[model samples]
Target: MDPKTALPLNTSRNMPILGLGTWQLKDDTAGTIAAALELGYRLIDTAVDYGTQPGIGEGIRRSGVERSDFYLVTKVEETDDAYEATRAYLGELGLDYADLMLIHRPPSSGPGEDLWRGLIKAKEDGLTRDIGVSNYSTDRIDRLIDATGEVPAVNQIEWSPFGYSDDMLRYGREKNMVIQAYSPLTRGKRLDDTTLGEIAGKHGKSPAQVLIRWNLQRGTAAVPKANQRAHLEENIDVFDFELSEDDMARLDGLNERFSSLGRLPYA
Candidate 1:
């Protein structure tokens, strides 16, 4: 349960299990990131569309932490050339290469075989240490593998106990793709639910901590967004205790495909 604990990738690299998700993080991005890094958070998630890339670069500089000490993930728009987009994102991040790069979504017309190929080339040229996809179905990933013969190192999705299903975990285990869980805290939308409240009261933990711990115990990476100091500390302080079998089963039963981002296409 160490803060820096990570899961392995198909590319033989380790991706941190817990991270800071910067979905709409724009104001004071540098300050928030700098604080997180100093507090032992090593994995950071952002996207080109988030417009926080420059701020992230500045945060890393402000933290006085070595660039290699943390894992950075960014996404490319599915329309642009993945390789060029990766290069451009690198510049915006002020880093030579990102730890991981992802296709933000699958192509509208097809499975994005060509875009996947571009990511393969980017990995070869070291624009990113590993390549992945976000918001992709398992079937779409299969098509990418069939066309390129390369499996994605990670598949990020909006996953939480409320939106849970065993399908993605089974496929991820079968293919060695880490399922990075975004919005693992449910965006604070369902934190006040009675079930979550009961569980939190039993464990003497906040509902948010329970949600994150569930992700970690299930073996997928969790990324919960937070900019405030108290919230950040609470998010990372989930390692001291473990949820029991009953707790896990009850949590699993709460799944109803809930998602603040609307219905996920994942199956």
Candidate 2:
């Protein structure tokens, strides 16, 4: 549960287990990111659809932290051309290279194999150091590997004590993929759960801290977003304590396959 803990990627890169998610931090995106960096967040997650890449890049520069010290993650939308989109993302961020790039989701009309190829090509061209996917089921990931003969380095999914599956965790381990958890706090939907509150009370930590610790304890990376300085500090402060096995089981029992993004069942 070390704050500086990083999981090894199949791509030979390491991703910090905890990061700042810039989903709705559209306004003052740069300022938010810069603040997160100052507060000790080494990983910053953004996406093409989030429309925060410009600010993200600017924030990184403003932080005065060398680009190599941070893990920068961005994604390509399903509608955009993967290769071209990767180029566009680099351009928008004004970065010569990205630490990681992901396919935001599968396109509605075409097979994702094409998009997977586009990501692979981006890696081949050195546009990004690592490549992965988001919102893709294990079967879809397998199909991409079968078609491209290349495995994804990570799978970004909506994972929390209430929404994740043991099967997905096993699948990720078997495939050597790092499962990055988005909405690890369940978007504040389950923060007030009695079980979570009890656990947080026991550790003298906030419910959000308990949830973030659960993600790390399960061996997945988490990206929790915060706009306020207090929240930014609170979110990354889960590294100091450990959740017991009994508490972990209690939290695991709360799972109902709930998706914060409204994608119930998450199949």
| lDDT of each residue in 14-38, candidate 2, tens digit only | 8999999999897688998889988
Each candidate's lDDT (Cα)?
A: 0.92, 0.88
Q: Pick the candidate with the highest lDDT.
A: 1
Q: What is the lDDT of residue 118 in candidate 1?
A: 89
- The residue-by-residue lDDT of candidate 1 on 110-227, one tens digit each, is 8898888988899999899999999999999999999989999999999988996699899999998999999898889999989889999998999999999999999999999997
Kindly report which residue pairs in candidate 2 clash with one another: none
Best by TM-score: 1
TM-scores for candidates 1 onward, in order: 0.98, 0.97
